[model samples]
Target: MEENTDINLSSGKVESPSGRDDGDKFNLQRKIFVGNISYRVKQHQLTKHFSQFGTVDYCYVVKDHLKKWSRGIAFVTFQDKKSMTRALQATDEELMLDGRLMRVAPAEESKRVSYSEGANWQTRLPPSLPTQTQDGDTCESDFHCSEQVTLPNVSHLELDACGECAIQRLYDDSLMLIFSFLSVKEHVRVERVCRRWRHLAQKSWNRQHKLQFRHMFKGFIKGLTDSILNSLLQRCGVYLRALDLSASPQLLSDLCADSIGANCPNLTELNVSGASVTDVSLRTIAQACPKLRGFIQERSFYVGDKGLTSLFQGCQSLEHVDVQNNAGIVGDCFHSLPTTVKYLNLDHCTKLSDLGLRKICLRCKHLTELYISHCKSVTDQSLINITQNLKRLKVLHMEGSYSQITSSGLKKIGQLIFLKELSLSQNSAVDDGVLVQCAVGCSNLTNFDISGCYKHVTDLGIQALTRCSDLSYLNISYLSHVSDSCVEALATSGKLQSLVARTCSGITDRGTSAEPEHLDTSRSSVTINMYNLSMPHLKADREIMLRPADSSSEEEEEKEEEGGGQSEPVSLCHQSVMAAGAEITSDNEWDVNELDGFECDDYLIGDDPLEEERWSLS
Candidate 1:
């Protein structure tokens, strides 16, 4: 009897420990790569050829659009990993089909071998196949040459047996997926091909309606020139709903702006946040994209009141506006800002004062979210204005070192019962009384981050804010005054999905033990980070389960004499996704220090250039 060489094939119930089921075996998919195939071969032919070693589930030959043959490469998927392995082993027999020695491998491994070591990675036959029936001295070439593809179990294949290439018969969606890998230059060149390619090419262009040219940044000095911008706009701008040229600042000249205003009339969101864009471009953009709901010009230092006034006057439907770092524009344009504007961000406008903010609060009374960070000139008058005018505000971020804002201002803030997200970090105004007031009124608050209030607030304030039934995200990082009681309250609260208590010195063994012990399993997950100092006795509260007498007290004493390792309670209860104990660290999936707790890429890609994945012809 022959010894079985298969790993997990007998019942096909046992899984391969090598993780062969994942798509990494073939990055394009979980398929086997077939190489050195003959040009005349078809999908049915390859399927039949490979069906001997496994149940050939799928087969595809890669080639050009109109080409009648493959690029000498193909892919096949088997019913099981054992079948794939066996098929790979069978390739050692030369696997000659129509006289070409075919090579088979996992697609990812093949990529590494083919690219790094070149084509020598392909294995050759042992010069002859041993058999009792064949003559001992006869070589494979001398005995017989493979002149035709012979599929043993497959007698005839009427479906897809002809030499027509698979690439030419791809559906419209598949063709668009292929064209999506092409660059702007390639898209332009692709249209100059046959009309079928052009139709599919236009569909591919129309697929992504947002025209973000940030990926096309060629160099630090160069950008998408006016001509190229106009060309792309002429092709895709009719369907384009948003245009983002924030990263490609070199394309912000008057001519580029003119082309954008002329071409992208239906655009609703525009981000031209570079220092080089002028008032002329801003005014032109205002005259054009009137349906613009969101406009971001964060660092445009040259833009002044005239351009902003023009923009606000024209874009009456604007809902979200970010003019954070533009110091050139003052409050003279405040009246022009639309009443429909619901979200406004003015983070670092050094020239903006309480007067400007009051004008905005009076005009855009329906504002839902507002951010005014690091603007030193803003005082209690702005907060008062916000409470009186913007009664519908749900999010308010006044997170900068502002001594001008007093407790009275925060008391007025409590009047806005609709507030859900509030940040008063680094401001000295927050105290226990104000927190109690806000907690009583704003029970609907979900996200509260007051990390820098170390001087004034203590456990009294922290506990008061925790009373807000809806508060799930709390960041009391540097609150050195808060004690273990706060941690206990938070654990039993059952609503805190995320807790960031970084340097709260009062959290020791007591706090750590109380967290997991009092954890409310009603909530699906809870992440607690206590990263001041390492607590060595964290496992003191855990109930130990003793084993048999064979591993008795003497052995336990020996282990204890060495070191009975103790685990910190910082590991989130109920198997939360992330945990931090001695130090706050992330497993690259989430950021520990970022305010949102998720990596920037989790929301979007920040600062990193958008590198579009381009498909290489392999």
Candidate 2:
């Protein structure tokens, strides 16, 4: 839930109610960090804007010391910590100052560098110098991880004239702030210190709402058991908000889901992609967390329409839902989706037809991001309906699905001016004229991937992409019609970062023929992967062969999508292999059994033979 931006401004500078002023102290503790202020905003204007919260003592806008350029950040100080607290209460609110929306948060303690009186350079050493093993480590350091750390012998120290303990004099909030900096292991140790310390440490644990299992265990998360999860959740209580198990493969099955549903009632975001959850688990989760906004149960073993329907009916406030690659979902499960949903992913739902999509467009009209990749049943009509209804759509990824979106549907897609990322990787109908319309229409386009559009999208369609000033990430791999000229034009765009041109036969044999050289890569940071090959027999899955280095062996990627309609290229590094049907040979017999895959660079040379008209052998 978003907080209200309504400011509680006061008339003028608030005088300290108790008549104690710390304006001369320059107390960094009682300060707030302000950001996104207009570059032209004066220091006094910032002070005036935040005067409603409390007494403003001083304000300073940060600048690049060398260039003297405004950093658009400011530090506002108050006479007391209460004023700082009042300002931080509106951390999520977009406070406008000088007609520009600004962000505010509690300022961290600042440490000044030793500098000369007039210069910014450090001319002298700082007040304190570091030596080895002076204080102890807070996190799981060497001594703590290797062996048990026994408490050291205590020595009495002098205190104030009064009988009060010196540490007890500090505010409880200050003590809790110190505890918040410690790691989870350190928190357990702090609890055994004393009664007061234990009480404060428990408060810190209860306030910790987000928990990622990967952070708790540095090694393989397979060691995570039900006992460990229940113990941690027992400490976090019902305040647990986000639970992520993406790193823990083969984690607790349905029982794990039941434990989470029973414990984490306040969960807002949950990812169980690595777990083996069933429809019963989803039903339990739906009944427990009604205010869930983002939920992901991708690549599940037993999840289907029955669980998804329960989720939509239970959590009406859901905004982001991803259930990709679950083949069990074959029915109209999208009709009950709430209007509040902004992002939806139904990729690899093979049986989903155009009717289910029509119902989605009619209900979730405010969708901004939609992913229906590898959903072959989705025809041109469903895509046209999406463009007509969802005007706020920004990121649409319908890669590798082989309904082949034609000009009528592509024309409707071009009208989506708000689109930023559009992935039409294997859609056969995205030809030269269709791409020209999209290049002219989507002015805000940044990421465009048309990797396997093949013979249809030539240099004419690719060159048209230069009109998109924001085009950054492009994948032109496997397009036989694309040439060096098209690649050169797009690289000069200055914004292109990742250009995946792995298997273009039209490219020259300059890089691959030599000892792994680059084609003018110094001009830009774009990773131009040009492993030019001519393997027409192989077929790649869009999601399977994307990040080539992720696969442990060749056999793992070849397991799925042999009978799919599209013949997409399987690209990963310099080598790729796609076995069609049961025709996949042994691991030793890839790419004619030579150097195999990316290693056989000599055999996989570019096929743009020198023509007499172009390079005449006179």
Candidate 3:
């Protein structure tokens, strides 16, 4: 058997190898010095591997001083002495690295002492360690190390106790606030952490008033059922104010409406446009949601006059009703419509006619905006009724309902001075007389559309509209008789912003080319689109030729002209227009030239071969 010996540096104590003093053993158990490590191993890799056994405070791989290459050795220090003890036990199992086994052991006292005396000893020592001089007094200088190397006084038990106290200091309300910032998915995920978090997450979800499950498309596997609605209502329906089930309305049934009516009593806005709801559901909503303000039941085919009557009778606070495209709705439904309603849209309700509109005008005096477009049954009598009553009307859309409306009705429509936007496109009977009446009466009109009125409208009608100086948007596309004179008149209005005159055969390049001069140059903003015009291609080519050229191209062209031999002579009018276009293209300067006749300078150039007979008149 080999003889064993033990040595202790602190207190100059010595003992047999088998009978080592506990105090000396504890003092030396601070750092584990590993040897025979792979040369390719880094400090962080060693630290990460050793951290699995215990909390490693610091790790260092020794390197060659000049070459900066790993020396196949490293040191790992731990915060507590118990962790060092566990790491020593764990090292008995071979640590494999790059198909090779590593060696680990407690550093020898001589090696530790040499390291303390090295030039980098000040940096290697832990920050929490206190240095002491030979006189037994703590010294502030980092160059010195204590005689005895010991672990920190903190243990695992003290760390656990401190963490628990920190958690206990937070109140329930503060904890809830911190949890509220997490997303709904995160809230559910963290519930598995402990019992307290699960309870708080459940409580927070219950208090949520606004619930939108539109993204959970799979959750509505079955149409919105009474059981599912009741389950949701039991949890959050009491406090719910806004519920959006707009997505997947096919899942909504009559029971879902009843569930909402019974549970969500404070509902203000309801949208069940494409649902399978019937007249029974509408009656239930009217009786249940007394405080309802806005209702949208577009395309709900089963809802007819009976449903409308029930809704109007129960929901007195209703302000907006949009029953668009509901063909079953007839004129008789407006008889029961609440007077409190201000905005009503009966668009595409083909069954509604003048009788229904008359009832609406007589009852709904607070109406400010009405859209009955595409209701072909509506005629001049409907518009006459609207103007007679709803004097507060600001927007009226009568598009596609021009079969029975003539200039006589349009003349009466001009009496509504509050009209700001008017659309009478596709009306064949609208002529210049109606426009004259509109200009004389409604001067505040901002947007006017008569795009498809191809019959009986000419420059006379456009000239009549010039009195409305505030017109910003004008659409007279497809009108065959509107010419450049109308465009010039519109440009001089000074406030025109957008003008759409597509397919108008009378508007030529010359007329549109001169139209810009009459615009409000002080504002410097004008947009004129002449799509599908007779000379669109020619106008595009002319616009390209009018683009300004650089100084090099200009000099080249001048030299070519100076050395001219058989080049064609350019017209004076065309040259002056090119110069004006170039100046405008280069500097954005507008030189508004009059449309008077131009002098061709034909006498100086000799007899011009390309000169037209019209030039002689100029």
lDDT of 2 by residue, 1-618 (tens): 113222222112233543333442445456666655688988877888788888998998887766787767788988766777777665334366666657555553222111222232244443222112223311111001111221121112111211233344344555677887777678779887556678778777866878776656656654666666777777774888898877664656678877888788999999989688877888898999998999998888788888888888899999998888888776477888889999999999887878888989999989999999998877889878888898889999978747555656776788898999999887777788878988898978999988788847788998999889988888887777877788778766747766777667676554233234534557744343345553443233344456665445555445445644434555432343333343433542333343343343543333222221232333
lDDT of 1 by residue, 1-618 (tens): 124332333124323453253423243223566766778888899999888887877888877667565666777887766677677678445478987667565543321122322123244222222121222221111112111222332112211322222243344556677887787778878886655668678778775568776566678777766787888888888778888877676555667778888888888998877736677878998898888998988788778888889899889999989998878756788888899999899887767877788899889878999988778777888888888888899998888677677887787888889999999876767788788888888888999988767667888888887678888899886676788898888878747777776656677767756367766657655455544552322222212333463443465566666786633333221122323342323433332343234333333322121221111111
Question: With candidate 1 superimposed using the best TM-score fit, by how many Å does residue 364's alpha carbon deviate from the native?
Answer: 1.7
Q: Tens digit of lDDT per residue, candidate 3, span 1-618?
A: 235644445336554554434665433455666655778888888888887777888887878766899866677877655576577666334366655456445653432233322134345543333433344433222122324322223234423433443442334454566666666446557566445656655555545656555655565575555576666665556677667666667766777887888788887778787877788888998898888788888877788898888888898998988889999988787788889998899988988878999999999988988988888787788878999999988888777745677779878988899988888776777889988988888888899998777778899999888898889989887787878898988878747788777667788866767366655557754455534454333222344456564323455577678988434554443333322223434443222243233343333233332233334346
Collision pairs in model 2: 9-52, 10-52, 575-598
**Model 1 error, position 611 (Å):** 47
**RMSD per prediction, one decimal?**
25.3, 24.7, 19.5
Better of 1 and 2 by TM-score: 1
Q: Candidate 3 at 457: error in angstroms? A: 2.0
Candidate 2, 300: how far from true, in Å?
1.1
Q: Using Cα atoms with residue i matched to residue i, what is each candidate's TM-score against the true structure? A: 0.56, 0.55, 0.55
Model 2 misplaced stretches (Cα beyond 4 Å): 1-178, 189-199, 218-222, 401-411, 488-498, 509-618
Clashes of each: 0, 3, 1
